[model samples]
Target: MIKAADLPQTLAVFPLPGALLLPRSRLPLHIFEPRYLQMIEDALKSGTRLIGMIQPNPMRGKKDALHHIGCAGKITQFSETEDGRFLITLSGASRFRIVEEITGFSPYRKCNVIWDGFDRDLGPEEVDKGFNRHSLMLLLERYFSARGLSTDWDTLKDADDELLINSLSMLLDFKPEDKQALLEAPSLTTRRETLVTLIEFALRGGNSEEMMQ
Candidate 1:
């Protein structure tokens, strides 16, 4: 079994938009692009087999800048398709802060990441005592109705606090910046709050693009 101490400081990052891979969660990725396909091949050869999933910064001027915070996930499952694409599942490991981006020979981005303040990520699953799951479900009902989205209600209801929020945060059709807010949230409680706020904002017909401006 790999421990946090075994994790490397330098990591390969996948700068995707609206992709949130929280600790203890699983993220499914389809690698079709040439750079990312190469990234998977190289990661499979590495010691940790982990990849940091970060989002591009949402600034209007700095379009290419990557976010400072991201979650690192272990490549727990990997499969190759006949069409020369990769189907991979990343099991969330820890959240890391980007110290700096490394200019490397590889086509994909790599970074020196610090896991200093995210010890909680590697610990046991977080418990949010005050989370109103019912209330959130009510809002989600309306929010989903507004967007014509459908989900397995029973599965969602059965999930614990951390899984429910993190899964919703990742699966929801929110703006990349809104998803970033959920990723950077310090705790499960805070993330639920952010999720609710986004749902309410959407219910009120508040456009995330307009908010980003």
Candidate 2:
């Protein structure tokens, strides 16, 4: 776990909607865009290999229009490909709220972030607080069948509660807003409840577009 003092105050952000990374979870990214390629290079060169994972507001056309909260991740794995693209995996370090955006010279945008509100993210994953995992699994079974998706239940059963919840929250085809809500959930219990509610709504044939509104 990274110490709060060691975390950077300012972070280079990747505004890719629907790509969610929770603390201690891993997210793999393919860097093909010139600006993002530059961002990776700068991250590698500098000691702080941290990058902010944020979502751009779809309703806004401005390049910098972003959600107020995002998670910071450190480059844990890196490999450069032959075509000049970088294949990197980030291990989430902490969540932050955007204090302010820094007007900088870099092609990619930077922001001054505050991690005070999410200090727990730096600690170990919380134990399950009697979250209804069985109900979630039942909903997932129905949801996957409805979508014609197959999964290895055997492998899934081995995952810890935190991994299971975070993985599902990140991998499911939920709306960007829904994903953001999960990311911003104050506690694991709350996150679990929110996730179950979203799943239940989807199972009941609720329109995601309507739910977002």
Candidate 3:
């Protein structure tokens, strides 16, 4: 429900590594950390209710701890638990580029963001011209079997192109760097290709997530 123009120049970001949220998708978060809990409360009071989900790339050093590209998500729903923790869902709005880190304000990290070149994110759902559901499903089945993971095949079969690709991209157990690669993919087709490539790599005796830097 957030327009591209409505996206603020500055945004509070959740720098959690290995968490990914793409446009039109939803990310569920359990916030217990004092800073993040405060962040949730502050976002509730703000007009946009938007929060950027970024990955902390330690390999990049503190000056570039957070990956430059991240997605801004709107806090669509939230509930406070008895333990003072918050269970919330963020609906992905649009991807952004961090212009600079805004320090010295709140406990959580804030950054100036640039929303240019992401207009296509707000439009209708993208159609993957090269999406072959059957192939993907076969690949997923083998991948799941190898990992001892289970999924609802009926549901996945029913999912559309964008949902199928984006959901898998968000939910897969890829390394933070691989997930970042998925996030930075220019289009849905590219994302799907990247995902397929990752899966293929994993199935072919590639290094495991634990082995990656």
* Best-matching candidate per TM-score: 3
RMSD of each: 1.8, 1.7, 2.2
Clashes of each: 0, 0, 0
User: Could you give candidate 3's per-residue lDDT for residues 1-213 as a string of tens digits?
Assistant: 788779899999998889999999999999999999999999999999999999988877666588999999999999999989999999999999999998796999999999998998888899999899999999999999999999999999999999999999999998898999999999999999989989988888685464344
What's the TM-score of every candidate structure?
0.94, 0.94, 0.95
- The model with the greater lDDT, 2 or 3, is 3
Positional deviation of residue 170's Cα in model 3 after best superposition, in angstroms: 0.7
Worst 10 residues of 1 by lDDT: 55-64
lDDT of each: 0.90, 0.88, 0.92
lDDT of 3 at 150: 99
Model 3 lDDT, full chain set: 0.92
Put down candidate 2 lDDT per residue, 85-159, tens digits, no spaces. 999999999999898899868899999988888988999887668876677778889999999999998767778
Clashing pairs in 1: none
